[model samples]
Target: MAAAGVSLGATVLCLLAWAGLAAADRVYIHPFHLLVYSKSSCEQLEKSSAETPKALTFTPVPIQAKTSPVDEEALREQLALATEKLQEDDRMRAAKVGMMLNFLGFHMYRMLSESCSTASGTVLSPTTLFGTLASLYLGALDPTASRLQAFLGVPGEDQGCTSRLDGHKVLSALHTIQGLLVAQGGAGGQSTLLLSTVLGLFTAPGLRLKQPFVRGLAPFAPVTLPRSLDLSTDPDLAAEKINRFMQAVTGWKMDRPVSGVSPDSTLLFNTYVHFQGKLKGFSLLPGLQDFWVDNATSVSVPMISGTGTFQHWSDAQNNLSLTRVPLSKNACLLLVQPHGASDLQQVEALTFQHNFLTWLKNLSPRAIRLTMPQLTLRASYDLQDLLAQAKLPTLLGAEANLGKISEDNLRVGKVLNSILLELKADEGEQPTESAPQPDGPLEVTLSRPFLFAIYEQDSTALHFLGRVANPLSTV
Candidate 1:
């Protein structure tokens, strides 16, 4: 009986030991516990263990215990504080950007103006005068009526001071500048700088002929004319003289006006030529002729056949056909023409076809196309070329003083630089809290580059002028 009792106790002890070992293995030798276990059996034990209940699948039962609710007012206050901080940061960033843009623009304008002035002086040099003259003559031969009228005297009894040769050249320069602004795709400030530069050139004495000579005499001195020659009777001589003058001024063969209405019919229609000569002391030559030509044209054409008028437009399809004819081998000219049509679409199409439009679609106001027979043409020119041609004489002789030109250039440059700096500074300055933001995913900061242009709402007459953030430095 004693031996049997001892055997039973030993068996119970062995069973308890086995159970304890199993429990320990389950608790401490789990897959996640292998690192803490002894290397001898931990890895094998972990591999044999069952996977634990995933936390994602373990939904807790609701507890009866009560908890405090979040404070809505306090949460709102915290959010407001965070928003304010974000806004402050944005404001600082904006201000800095604005200042930098303004500075850059101003300096760029100054540089362009200075360079233009310097170029004007150099182009007017005696060595360069002949080339300049050649360019102007070639430019006059362009098919566009507005350009032709600008270079040559307007034909009519109403011809006044504006019809004078000098006045025509000035107008041509202005038109040229307008075209250039359109072609170059820049802010109106560039055009303004160009305008100012040309005006300065006009005032410079180097451009004006010092000795007054007969207009038609120098070229045709060998050919004698009858004292009382009738213009109608001497059509040949008149034509020859006109041809010589044109050749001397511009180096291209002159095409006689086609016997139909002038191709510049739109430009000349109901147009009044206004003349304002120099204002006393301001005159380059004391009675130097100043002419202002203004006109309005209206046309009604079939919708399918596009018809309208615009100062400038672009043509993507006919890019190769578009060409830049020099106003002078050395000068600049301004040219303007009126475009008209029954509606916007037709006019735009025509302008596009002719390559008169600027690349900037947003800034383009309108397009003009005229229907004259089978031909369609767009009016365009280089402002600098026009000015160079008009101011060609100024580049010649001792009168082409570098110091005066440099001073003028610097003054213009400073003004442009200041403007740019102010604009950039404004951009850099933080926006006030009171300033409202636009409600859109695409926010347009007023600080971004912008362009402005003027248009006569009733007509295709577009005068583009404005500031841009960063004008590329290609020019």
Candidate 2:
């Protein structure tokens, strides 16, 4: 995929050089003294090599975007040239996003997952997190965009005037899936699925965000807010004020808000996802069900069980089992739990895996009486911490040129992602939860910790991911 990006960038660079539209970035070609041809011959060869291409293509090339005060025209032309490539790249965008998000998800989740190792579950929305960074990429220049493009699994664009695989395209692709989930939020049953998200941009009172950057975030339904913060004078106080703002917006769904706002920071980014899943014909166990909170301890919690034909598989070598149940027209609730003596941690090490879905493609439906805990969770993270954990601490570093984000020198404040997930029974369909159990189906119970991910059926995007240890705790 990166090869495609490099090729596209190189192609555009080659075209621009041929037309004399690019001057800032150059490839110096020189014929030297000894191994090279004589000076006279070298001069003639260079002239012909440079002029031959322009001669072959009679069409006069227009000025590129970066060379002028207005960049829209250049970007549009670039997009036009890459239409075929963009279409092909768009087809694989979801898979690309999934692989990249999960890869980042695994590393990011490792730290917080372990922090909640002995507690309840931890939840996260890969799309929400990825979108925020992608938005920043919209405003970023060169090196910063270059670093983030790899993290985002997006290709590089022409510089001075850069590439056309704009951050907006990636964010829009994700928003399209989100739109599908919201539209397909099926009617009441034991499991009804609904998903929605919002982005909050809090900036220092006087800083101005770039038009393109602001426009790029419109699809994500961002709420713009300018707040007065003496960031440089008192960063800690500024952090607290921003934290309060987020708490009010999220209704305190997240704890601690986000800490460590740089003193020079002019803005902060936050996004939240709300998801509710209720399954039909799945009812609570006769009584409180016992759960193994850890290897050495156990607690009783409300549990639900249902008998049905569902896709099921296992990695016996890893003592893990996966059960996929449909939630809505465009989504499914995927459950992964440890079997026998295997711990949830081992299963955590496996969820959001690259080939896991490839393996799931071959899942054979089977009859099983599956029992899972009543789930209610809220998981939160500081995005900067995730970058640091991924060993790319320089992403939002000082050298980053985020001109599109704001005109002022901005310091990024709390980059937070908070996700809320609740599994419940539909109020109107309460009685349907009591359908007769199958006489001889296999009994599979999640009376212990387990890992889970929600998939958007159409796009096959990993919407939300987490591990549940205790049904009650909000991570």
Candidate 3:
């Protein structure tokens, strides 16, 4: 009897080990890696799956929206033709990436600036906005993923699995941009910069998000707080809760309370970015200076003055002049002002042209006196609203599979991105008395509504885009 019992126990142990081995053969790829497409990555994915790749598919019901269906086929073909001229090898290079990012930056800047022109100034972090969209791409399935790829301007004519947009590459490039800022902000750098970014994911109470999806946000933000809140309970209370939570975490207050949360919503994505840049040789003057909000209106705002040899360009044809001011070894600030006869709207519209930003490369150095208002600007807007205005309200709507975000169907509510920008001018070491005086260096004064962008010097990667309509207005 003892021998028979031992034999049965041994048989059970053998069966258990075999079952474990079979389970181990079925590898689970994180949703973050699903969008990573490469020949070797594809091979690895195939080897990990015990069954066909289709077996690993996760398709959820699309979050419903009240809008007309978009022509996906037409959009895809248009994008293909637009990028057909570029050589395949140049598609994902640094230059192309810069242009692609600028393209998206100009689009978002236009939407935000135009909407806020009547009310207040507009400021946006293009890198942060791009990362927000890329995070969603990680949770999207094809058709939805393809649409995002087209919007992202990922180089490639084919949108198949083998040639899918590489989320990893996009995130990596964004990370590089952030790293440049950090290096430029280090101690003893040419300028003093403080940049803080945080992403908040608020979900319905008791809702569970995919662990992999939450972890995938690491590349985009150092801190991503995912919390459960009953958003529908009381809109006012919900806003307070989020505001208090963000304040406690980052110590920065939102200029306005978050709104547009829906009772039926399942998730609200919000990102807060705070940026402060102080020029080394620029110093704030004591009294307020006149900043023309328009032809007839003017406001007294704190002003900063500096004298330096800066790169300048006057585009008489476009009725705008640009000045490139160094912020650090790897970053510079582009200040663009329209000619007196031209309005901000006209100059802004011209930015949509393909070669508009290339003007940065054509600037010539000239010694000059520069004065501008000290800027403390804040801008807050929802991405969904922008999409609605852009006539693609159904882009993230129902029929879009977001299975990777959550097993339970998710109805995304409002995706908000906010910015708080503070630009100060500091007095550096006093100029030497023996230095040669320029022969009437041109004087450039930004006393009116103007556009500004912070860019990585080498790559020309746009970090921030904004329009200062009123130096006194921050919203």
Candidate 4:
């Protein structure tokens, strides 16, 4: 219930901002203004009496490594205090941060989907990516800091320290969002939703890391494990080591070893996220169904179907239809599919429009029979590559100052953000074999390439955005 109220006002504010403000409130407030902080204020907050965040060390563990013991009560107390600081203006600011991350992650999703359209579809965790950038911002200095700030959608950066933003506030807001999701999801038990994240910092041997910088990452992930590895000499071995370490610690098995690590790089920031959603009224169909990857390509895959009243919209003008299926009381799934002969590319282009989020707001409830694949979508990408694609090659390049993270002339390696999404029928629900009535629900089947998004109903936050071109591919 607490999670439901976290930034609940933000959803209303966003709607008012976009849907046109009332006559009494004609002064339009830009969302970014909510997050702006004066330099003096940021400095004062940092010097406050809050306990210093614990510094994590890069100590290597064995192949079958076990997670270090954590004092659950102590960690909870610390998090509760940190979150308590975010109850007032911090809530709206966190909501704005979530919005900013959604925009950035949307663009990244587009770029990735384009590059991998033929081979496989793509998935991105906006929250995880935001945490990665926020982590980097923790160590950035001068122009690098300014650039990262701009990338984060904070305005008025050109002005001076008076307009500087507090990295702690942003990271704290991010932590609040993560906490809200876990709390809301767990309220329904494992039968509804289960979400987890792990932050892995793979550093070069003997690279001295700053205490404050390492300590600052505490709130952004549940498990922040920094380890030393011989990444440069044998990249394959390092990848295998990371996979083994994660499996040993979290019991999460990766489909393949991570690739694309630069041998010259020093620190690799890796975040792994897992999310599973079980539909209430859905059940697996008897056998495989024909899924149209494109107009010409098709494959047989497992399908699930259910009949229920769902929030839906058909944008005939844009040649696409939107469907919102409930995953839990706090989260839902948005499915967008192009009509007629239109393809996934056409649907992707629609995201660039200013009124994209409005589509979600405009959905109307409709009784329909929805049939879609039983998805186990997996995606991996290096943040460095995404930066290059955005034409910001030097944001983390050699010239950047990262003194807060390390003194060595460090080459930032692959900032990996791996995501896995699983959606299946709730085992408690039984499949119905009754014949359709004369006035049956409208049938809407996803047999072609389409786009999907996981959204938080309470905060109106976009957690994950992705496209599914083929049901069989899990890249």
Candidate 5:
């Protein structure tokens, strides 16, 4: 009986080992052969998927307001040529902001998604997060700076010097993208985008800030310093003071965001972003659109409609469809929607990769009639907590040397980032005659939970990343 039991145990162990190998075989890569991936396995999974690649059948239409210039005979060719020339501050347009956002948005999604899972709507400023990190990069020293460079995706200035990470260059690139959006009527035309960036460093008494760090922020952030308060006691008072300061800075238009303060801390880093945008040729649909909350539930909210020739893409593997509508002269609103039959969670894995934005650039130009809810989003996040969630708390922890920010032994405390985005169409606005008549137009509606991002066309970097699962929910 003991011999029989031993044999049975050995058989069970063998079976478990076989199962483990089988599971790993599906996704595992040999450490030494990292470049090699199983094409057959990937193909098998794609072929087995229920969703089919959507056909890009929508015919292209002329895209221009009545007051705007006439569409050229070679309009599509002209657009393709123009788009090819698009470059922002020496970085490729495809990865400029997409790379940074993919890094930061994942953390924000992980940290905020659960809280928003209950309410069903969440917004994050990838640009603000990027700027904050750039500021941190400016203040960090040695190993901390090296770690930050990796986090910010700064590929060093070629071979000779891998020692010092250039924070100014990274910040300037981000600012250049913003500059393209904020410029009034460049060769691209008048933009309907209004973006306000404010970066603040609130330091306790006595410690003097560095001139280099102060000047470094000028290109990236309009407001870098000039406020202080006792962070020692009374969390409520600190909140009030911060709120009041923010109000004065923003003309009292934003709501107060809650934050925690440390008694022993001497410094607080804050970044605020406010965005207001309007689609030039889009019109508001008078009725509230039905946005599906789940398989059996839905909510009603105001929706806007637009029609024009736009770039569109669909993926069968991820169960997602995407399109780009120019939000301003230089910024485009890239919208993604999962099939009504599928949940938002179905396409979520795509966000973790750079492929999400890459797919947008490869879309075929098609005529589309889109209906989406007007956007009003206000969110605040603690950068320190986000960094901790990223598993690198020590990079900006109490032990961090932020000498570039100030000469004293400053302990970096709470880092707060606040964002306000208001996206809407003009009341009683009407679409131009050139707008595609809905008869056979590719009708795309955000009547279900969908993801949206506003990216600079010149740089292709996302400024705002958000989703509207329940539009009526309080932000």
Candidate 6:
């Protein structure tokens, strides 16, 4: 009887061991990885059961929630202690700021790399995505802490030494993380939890106290202008005016001529202007058109054209009207010649009013010190010699550069111009007649800070630039 009992016991033990091994094989440690593993394991189990007569009991292991217990009272005391310590230890504050910035940079790269796909449609690798998200998470979490260091006005080495860890920064960071997850297509309860936690952290006054005073002050600050402008508009008159301004400011000419027949002696041109002063404000006024031209048939209608001190001759084409202005050395004047011979005077008057109003709208009454550090103008480029150099993306195919331009490119141009104007306005300066010579590419550099604003004339919607200096500080 004893021998028989031992045999049975051994058989039972063996079965238990086998079951344990199977469970180990099927187990997934990480919750995220479980979705992929669970399906495969269940399929395998079903196949095995079909082949074998034995019953295979499969029980899924409960996912262990990984969380640290938080005693609210204890955390408050610890945080208070930390704040006191920070007041004395400059090294600690500096270390924290460095950690936060490193984290931020990582996430910024991650989000941008993941969200933006190349024109060819290649997605970012998982490893890359992970790294990017991690970086952004860290950065968003500590902006206030970092900004506080900036505010204390501490000099190097000792700077940020006494900085406080802003709870607000943590909340902001969490919010940003939730946004990034949504952007990456994550949905469901986990995302909701993250958002809720962030909101709760922000609502706590003690946590809010941890944020920098400057960060707190952000909400009460006045709206500023943008660093760029988008002046590209349809209706030949608007485009023409913008082009003339660019020519007058930059001393450059359009690579191609405007489409359609010029009115008797009238010429069509477009130019991108550069100004040194900061932007203030901008407004647009709608008025009745003096006359209408068949825009659908017009090929390249000149926006702005005039003879300047640095004149360059453009090769003539029958279907196009061309104008070249040189703005390199001296202040240049540009005369915009409108199409339609019968209403030539009306066109001229409209063009002049449009230019004047645009200029006036951009100059705001509120004064703020603003400067533009850089500016760039992008347009369709025509390669005079294809064999001379490998064609880059900017070069339009054999199709005429200006003639083949699409609505998207025009929209992009307008956005860019509007942003520029806004940047100038934010700096509390008005655009003046300072046509800085282009040293390298078609770009300009401002001596002071600036603001940016963008407007879509078609939709009449204003798009503000989200930046550290702008109204939307958290983004």
Per-model tally of clashing residue pairs: 68, 14, 2, 0, 1, 63
lDDT of 4 by residue, 1-475 (tens): 1221232335434433643333347674434444556556757756763655544434344334457543433443343345434565666666667777776666666667667654367788888898889889888887788777767656443565556656776887787776555443333343266666778877888776776787788778767887777888988778787787776766665675477567887778888887878887798999799998767889999999888778889887888889888776457888987785454576677753255687877898777789999999888888888777666777888788887787766778778888878989885743234344578877889988887888775456678887787888877
Candidate number that wins on lDDT, 2 or 6: 2
Q: What TM-score, computed on C-alpha atoms, does each candidate reach? A: 0.18, 0.72, 0.79, 0.82, 0.73, 0.17
lDDT of 2 by residue, 1-475 (tens): 2432452344334333533432336763221111123446546756887876421111111111111122322322332233223344354444445444554554455656665544666787766777778778777766777777656643333332223235665665655555545443334411255554556566665666655566667655434333455556776776676666655544535553556667666666777666777776677667787788767888778888776777888787778888887666557788887885455665566655444566677576777777888877877788777676556566786667776666577677667787777786543342222235456666778877778888776556677788777776667
lDDT of 6: 0.23
lDDT of 6 by residue, 349-374 (tens): 23222232233233222211121222
Q: Candidate 4: where are CA atoms >4 Å away? A: 1-65, 68-88, 156-159, 185-191, 352-354, 427-438
Model 4: how far is 368 from its true place, Å?
A: 1.1
Tens digits of per-residue lDDT, candidate 3, 284-328, equal 989888888877888999998888778889988888888888776
- State the weakest 10-residue window (summed lDDT) of model 3: 58-67
Q: Write the per-residue lDDT of candidate 1 for residues 1-475, one digit (tens) a residue.
A: 2332242334334323532353554453221111112354435545654553221211111121222332323322332232223334233322222222222222222323334421111011111111122223222222222232222212212223222223222222322322222221123211111110100011111112111111211121111111111123344553344334323422322233111222111100000000111111110112212111112322221111121222233343432111111111111111111221122223223332222324323232222221111111111122233334333222221232222122221100000000010011111212112223254121111111222222212112232212221222111
> Model 3 Cα displacement at 71 (Å)?
45
Which numbered prediction scores highest in TM-score against the true structure?
4
Encode model 5's per-residue lDDT on 237-347: one tens digit a residue.
766676666665555255547467777777778887777788656787877778777779987787888876778887776788888876655677888888754647656
Of 4 and 6, which scores higher on TM-score?
4
Judge candidate 3 at residue 337 and give its lDDT. Answer: 88
Of candidates 4 and 1, the better by TM-score: 4
Candidate 3 ranges with C-alpha deviation above 4 Å: 1-36, 49-96, 116-119, 155-159, 185-191, 352-355, 429-438
Clashing pairs in 4: none
Location of the lowest summed lDDT over 10 successive residues in candidate 2: 57-66
Please give the RMSD to the true structure for each candidate, in Å: 40.7, 13.2, 16.7, 6.9, 16.7, 28.8
